[model samples]
Target: MPESLKKEIGQFNVFYIDYDNHDKGYCQSYRRRGFYKISLLEGETKLFYADKTMTFKRYALLFSNPNIPYSWELTGNNHTSFFCVFTEEFIRQFGMIKTYAVFKPGSYPLFELSEEQFRAFKDIFLAMQREIASDFLYKYDVLRTKVLDLIHAALRLQPVGKLPNKEANSALRITSLFTELLERQFPIESTLQQMELRRPAEFANHLSIHVNHLNHSLKEVTGRTTSQLIADRIIREARSLLQHTEWNIAEVAWCLGFEEASNFITFFKGREKLSPKSYRNSKIE
Candidate 1:
């Protein structure tokens, strides 16, 4: 990781990666416990996670909730880049409207940007960088506005595909809320020995509903069982840690809440058709 590029300011921070002074050796990936990133840039680059290549006309919004590991490569031409990093708390404090529908899990990772829209976003980042550097009063508050403006602009520009109608069923809404809550609890750290409610019975009990009812509601909407969804998330986290971090297999296994290293290996192999180490190695290739 680039030492200077890695920044932490209280709870929220933003950084700009200028192609001019930046070096390929300094190009590195980072994994944090809880954060989301939006990348605004120009020129061609390959985003590794979604296995997609993007140009200056394309913008990338990555909704990572501390569990998913992500990285990028600027292979083609040099271009300016800006990344805004913030936690849930930072976003909530800004008082921006929450359109969870746009950022929900499994959403598409890229959006094409119009020239005018790109210019507008570029201005926002420029202002944000200025705010970060200025010694003016209430700078944080001003920065907050810029952040909210960027989010609002993206929501307005991007098409959020058909979301589950909230008016349909109250039970489904509650179930959806419960599922979102469950997802938030994940990318669970390995040191947490006792499971913090992983099973369907546990979730149902927490939600004050029967296990069958929880299962039924989740299946109705997501087309997957609760356990399956949780397992999939775990696998995603495992892949991220294996690919992005220097942590070893046993450590990675423990971090994902697996009791034994062997069990983690078996589970990962079953899902990915490769061991963690093998998968990590493949990513670099």
Candidate 2:
């Protein structure tokens, strides 16, 4: 993360993509960015999300949260679009953004937009850009509404279903807390910034609950065990460090809570089918 960006976690920025001014560096790698992003893409593109590949030949709206690791490639000539990136603090007053399905963990955040819908969304983004640049007072208030507009617009596209029951909603809330806690420890920027919560019991203890209770809550909502979720997130961070940083395997292991490089290698290989060094080399090639 850039130093300037690190200081502006509460700020937001909007942009209109001029192909001439577009930079591929922004979409170059699958890593957890320090902020959230919502983009309206108007060209052919391939999105490589963790364990999933989605190719969009036309228009698509992509919602990226700080927790997920992702990257994209432009496959077509036309690269015009609109996008806005903001940190959680930028919209913290609205509510927990992760509670929404599009930003929720394990949910696919991409939405296909029709031409008409695209036009409408374009208007929203343009409005946001305009408002953000204006000298008017309470412009941020207006921007917040526009952000919610974009989210609600995508929600409308999703198939309607029966509302989640009370019990399920309770489970969902616990899942959201677990997801937030897990995400808070990420984007690990340095070797000295070792992870403090690497075990399920530690997380549960921190939350003042039993380990089995935490596992039950996660399983109820995500259908995955607590250990599985923790391991998956560790793998994600390990991959990011391997590809995006110059850290050696041992450094990566230490940052991720593995005391020894061999143990880290074994853990990574068991999940990824490739050693950390091999994965990094593959990305380089």
Candidate 3:
């Protein structure tokens, strides 16, 4: 949000945060920002992702996807970091950004870094900063290449594993289809666009399968029932809307398929142990 520290080129922007000027601490609750972010942290910090917490004692790389809600704060220690924020449209030509594992919905996007590794990434961010302020006509192209470099470097840092051989499995295929259908209804772009499939029966009907068949496939693959999975994902979206959106309880309820605000209150309290308003207030500064 600092105007001077940010350098923008098209939909991409990079920022510099130095130790002396770093704010004491701040939290950004999850919301759909429709942008991707990559940050290089150079001190102690704590990251809060959906249902997970990770601490970094020194250097670390964090990748954020617009679909996932995450936040980080300095742990009362001196910190210096550089970050870049860009929309999917900014780099769509390079590749399908979501195909990368780091930006996947249930991925561990944080990576601890050595001094050498940190400096390598820091150099890319610095180059981005300089390029954005340059007068060159094709500087945006250069920045796009630099962004890919950062992504590839982070991928290398990840632990490599032997991939399993592809095999035909009907249950797995059904589960995959179910997951796609479930994800397609997410981010709840507007109040007018209410969720149409909040139940396994509805999802099964859309997939042209029986509700029992869909439930069995999901349970076999994910070790959880279909209804449970739907509820979990709904709760996550509800939390995000509560924390980040100005829509009142009634609007949020309707957006998530609850016909009444009271029904939403009861549903939210059952899972989160607090009312939606209280959850929103807890995130307020």
Candidate 4:
């Protein structure tokens, strides 16, 4: 965190910047703040995302939210994209987060375009660049609406099965809230940050429900127990931290909520068949 007054940043912000390369797209300066990011990108792009690596070849429409951890690199072509980022605060003022599938997990992140699709998306992005450059009042309002139009437009091209219907069912709704709450605990980007919810009961208490009820909803919807889901996600993040970061075993353990480093070592070895240090070393080798 920046100590100076000049360094404290506002929750609602936007940017249009150029990428330094395909491998790091304007990534050197920006700290992730769980913002909603939209980019109309060209070239072969790679995104290291959520324990997976995915690549887009030449022209893709991309959307991402802060709950996901990702890094973008270009493998070919100049990085030319119109990028915009806004926080949950911006969305909350005009729309509910739950209403937009664009920010949620399992949300569609890329739309591979047909020639017709490419032309249509290109118009919208060009219009965005033009309208945002104007000094007119309420331009951001127009811009916000345009962003929604783009999201809904890309959403239409997705297979109907992949899109979530209105989630009015009470059990499904509860499960959604649980999963969102669960996902919010992750992407563990900083050494100073720590997991806030480590146990099912703790999550249940925070959700104003009984532990048994939370477990039931999750199992009913996902066919997995609450503890299983939590453990799986923690292990996924553990592997990512081990492979990608220079944080030592003790620091990694502390970030994941282990009071004793030995406990983390045991938990990791049980699941991964190796100590954290061994796994990390293996990654480098």
Q: Between candidates 3 and 4, name the one with more favorable lDDT.
A: 3
Please give the ranking of all candidate structures by lDDT, highest first, separated by commas.
Answer: 3, 2, 4, 1
Candidate 4 lDDT, 1-285, residue by residue in tens: 233212213433344445554345424213464467777776677765433456767777777765445567677556667666766645555766556766555554666666677677778777767776776555566766777778788778662123234432444556667777876877799999899898999989988989998887666545568898788778988998999799988899999999899999999999999999999999899
Tens digit per residue, CA lDDT, model 1, 1-285: 333224235556778776867674223344564566667766555553322233333444433333323466665555667777776656665442224543443343455576777788888888988887877656667877887777667766654232344422544454556656665665444444334666788788878888887777666644567788678767877876787678878887877767699999999999999988899999989
Worst 10-residue lDDT window, candidate 4: 1-10
Per-model TM-score on C-alpha atoms: 0.52, 0.57, 0.57, 0.52
Better of 2 and 4 by TM-score: 2
Tens digits of lDDT, candidate 2, 93-190? 89767767888755667887778888999999999988987866677778878989999889888521322356655555567778888878977998
Evaluate residue 147 in candidate 3 and report its C-alpha lDDT on the 0 to 100 scale. Answer: 92
State the local distance difference test value for candidate 3: 0.78
**So what's the TM-score on candidate 2?**
0.57
Sequence-dependent TM-score of model 3 = 0.57
Model 1 CA lDDT for position 212: 81
Evaluated against the true structure, the overall lDDT of model 4 is 0.69
Residue runs of model 2 more than 4 Å from their true location after superposition: 1-10, 20-26, 29-33, 159-177, 181-200, 204-285
Worst 10 contiguous positions by lDDT, candidate 1? 48-57
